[model samples]
Target chain A: MVEQSEQYLLTAYRETGNLQLLGRLYEPYMPLVYGLCFKYYKDEAKSEDAVMQIFESLVAKLRVHEVSNFKSWLYTLARNHCLMDLRTESRVSTVDIEEHLVESDRLLHQQYEEPITEERLALMESCLEELNEEQQRCIRLFYLEQKCYKDVAAITGYDLNKVKSYIQNGKRNLKICMERKQE
Target chain B: MNNNYLIIRIQRYLNGELSREEMYELEREALDDPLLQDAIDGYRLQQRVSHRQLSLLQQRLADRITQQTKERHAFYFGWQRLGVAATACVLMVLVLVLLWMRNHPDPQRGEKEVQVELAVPQAVGIQALPITGMAFDAEPAQGWKAFNAYLAEHMGNELPKGEVLLAFTIDEQGRPAAIRDTEGAVAELLAEAKRLLDNGPTWKGNTGKIKLIFR
Candidate 1:
């Protein structure tokens, strides 16, 4: 997965000049990236632009990131970009109503896609809700934002290693949460 | 990873908290560890469900940000390369606007700083003492200036009594009430001892006692 994830990052960085390859490389990861934007800004179009801006920023700063964990790295980048956009926009007006689309997009997208029939999903949502805000945030960044540990750190303003620990702890807790319900 | 270590690490991993090396280590271990694999599977399922819930939220926020970004950056995004002319025009407009606002009559001028005086006097205590008064230089009974002939002879003793206990009573502020048990010369030795002890540096003892033993 490391090798694959790295390959994807390298490809995206190198071939962003080509829209086709750029889309193909990023499309699979879009949900995670978009999820990050929506999480912070809670709007689709703004988050979508956030997604675009993240890609734009990624392309702009492609040469600088010595990515140890590519997925986590992207998540950090996406989360940071979304927050920056949120800050920039705050001085202008309130978070746009379109940003609220994030709530609706979840249901609409789920229904649009193959309905995730797994029974564990319900339990998982419940488990997630039970987590403290920071833990839940860390989890969403990891799975939904597809951010790497270091990236999560950059976005959350935590120490680099603490992000890793939070995700590691969050995962163990989520696993326990799912199993507890089964028992 | 040990079971305990892995449990902790796996939680962070599922939450996307681990670094590249940490993640690789876990992923490598999961290949052989069925328990870990199951854990990952459950977490993956959790991710799917969570992402579904988060998508709507992302959509609405993204739209607002896009509109705002466009507005803030509108000046820079013109379809021509006339950067210098555009910048000059904007700068002049800004200067003129500031000048206009400054020249306009403003209601918020000559506002005075409100002066307030609080004459709350704090009570301070002063204790008066005269030179040669009993407590003026009242110190420890040690190095007593033997005014009497008996104490003068015993002043420089060959065998010095070290830390002998003197039992006595004290009022609330540790002033001696009376000498509880005094024998021989010390029976009438109350005034000097009281003056000395009252103004003396205490070594070790509670002052609020009815009878305090001092050595």
Candidate 2:
């Protein structure tokens, strides 16, 4: 339902050339863009600037590119823009372009494993129940419902960083719990 | 302790914060262990959340755009008002100038033939009387023919034909003064005529540049 509404807004913005429509389309995902920028730049001001700059660029770019999934596409585009900016700035720092390329290559080459067996999946589910209330909610919303961290935070009313911490801590606890059950 | 460190490394790897070597080691480790791969999948889920704090960024951008739009509209409206006011002032000034021109006219403009009409009394008896004051009765006691006949007899046939323009002023004592003709031939005749006319009656009001055109 949300995806359909986003698609409708994207189409309306393209047809009408109304920035307000574009603004509505981008507003929900502003946190994701800012978070991604913060991860790259690490400076609060630079991250904020990057989020605004990404939207400005999106106005011209979204018109040309045929995007299927706006969220994933926007994520990749924002990451690329930040990576490029970091690459340019890295000339002044000790970080080399070769290291960035190697990291990108490693991420690209990484493959996913087969789905967990039915018995292991059952064990994981029971282990999930052992987590704290906040962790349980954050894990269910993020891993099962497939909501982004920002959406999870919005639904759970947790801070963005707190949501990430909960999910991370919960995942570790669930793994430990599952291992003990196997032993 | 090793498992805790590994979990931290997996989280960092999902965030793209892992160093190139650490990332390569993690990828190799995950490939060897199916349980570690599941943990990697869980870590990837945590990376997707966008926090509530960044909504402030969106608000600020929206405000800036709205402010710029308002300022542009105000600038355009200001110019529009100024243009309207300037046009009204120009029209008002034009109307005032037209009214002023209509009220105060040029005396020497258009008509060249100047005529001055006055109330002259008729001669009662052929005798000159001493004028007492500036004010007197303008109604004639007798007739104008006798006064004109007396002037013709004194000037004889020296009065020119065609048109003779005589200019003079009636003094405060109701006596003719500064009697002169533009044609020098009728100057003496005009003086005699003025004297006879003055004797016939007392002039009461202003007789300014009286033109006597004798044709």
Candidate 3:
């Protein structure tokens, strides 16, 4: 897939002046972008809109989008666009976040063992049920939404270090719960 | 990435503290080390799961984007396409209005033939260097492949099956002065020619070529 993707990239860039290939190459990873937007705003409609706008401009400018990794470029494009949309709308005004993020996503070639099972996922869910509201939201914000620690801190009224502590602790507890369920 | 290095990298990566070299190094290490790979995998998995697991997100986004783009473009161009249904539209009227005034031409806006000068002059007075066959990729010359790849990267598109003809001027100093190619990227081809001309050890004359092609 990587080689084929590279072939497509080279062909797309070299054969046609169309920068639209960046969008096709990046379509599979839109979930990550949407997921991040949803995490911050908790609104699917706006998140979808943000993702759309990002790709629209992104594809048009693909000819000059100096990038080695397509994944990271897509990630950054979506993230930056999403953040910009968020600011222009001012809906996340209450959800004070610092440091506008724009980074690339790299497609992983190797498939690693997803040791997580249904039972483990269920246990993890239950662990989430047991956590305090702030901690759980932080877990989702930091881990799932790809929000920074400072953003998490601002969202949930936790300090910077406290945000990290909550995420680390949540993961630890989730692992422990899975281990216990296996036992 | 060993267990220790993997953990450190993950933390650093998340914090956005890792340099580009370190980021690349971490990525390569994660690719090879199964244990480190597992940890990074776990980290990403955890991130995804936490992101609320939305499917069909890309397609939906694309559709929405396509919609928004159409709307925005239409907003600006609404009146332009409003009355173009019949052949005798307002544009014909406007053109007739302008042509009638040609007898009484606007002295301020004189219709000077608007002769735009060409950017790259025609490659006159220079003989083309020769190649054996139509295929350029087949040629394994000293710097042909390098030049090909470099030009390919800059051109941002693949050259088609037809021969790409470029016309360029060579100065007295043997440097390529100007280049022009409508079918292919002019700049890229000129750069490739310049690179080859620079590195050639046993060169003969100084003048650049007109219509340098794969054929």
TM-score of chain A of 3: 0.48
Kindly report which residue stretches of model 1 are placed more than 4 angstroms away from their true locations once superposed: A5-17, A63-66, A91-183, B1-215
Lowest lDDT sum, 10 consecutive residues, model 2 chain B, at B116-125
TM, every model:
0.26, 0.34, 0.32
Error of 3 at A44 (Å): 1.3
Q: Model 2: DockQ against the native? A: 0.06
Residue-wise lDDT of candidate 1 within A58-78, one digit each (tens)? 645655555554544565466
Chain A TM-score relative to the true structure, per candidate: 0.44, 0.53, 0.48
Residue lDDT tens for model 2, B1-215: 14436655766677767765566567545433333543354335445433343457768768755765687799999999999999999999999999987997756653332322112222211222222234432322233344344443443344454333444456777665665655564555455556556564445444433323343
On a 0 to 1 DockQ scale, where is model 3? 0.04
* DockQ top scorer: 2
lDDT of 2 by residue, A51-85 (tens): 88888887788776666667656755776787788
lDDT (CA) for every model shown?
0.49, 0.60, 0.51
What's model 1's lDDT at A44? Answer: 49
Q: What lDDT score goes with residue B9 in model 1?
A: 68
Task: Give the better candidate number (1 or 2) by DockQ.
Answer: 2
Residue B215 in candidate 2 has what lDDT? 33
Write down the worst ten-residue block by lDDT for model 2 chain A: A102-111
Over all chains combined, what TM-score does candidate 3 have? 0.32
Highest lDDT: give the candidate number.
2
* Model 1 per-residue lDDT tens digits across residues B71-94: 547756653447767888999999
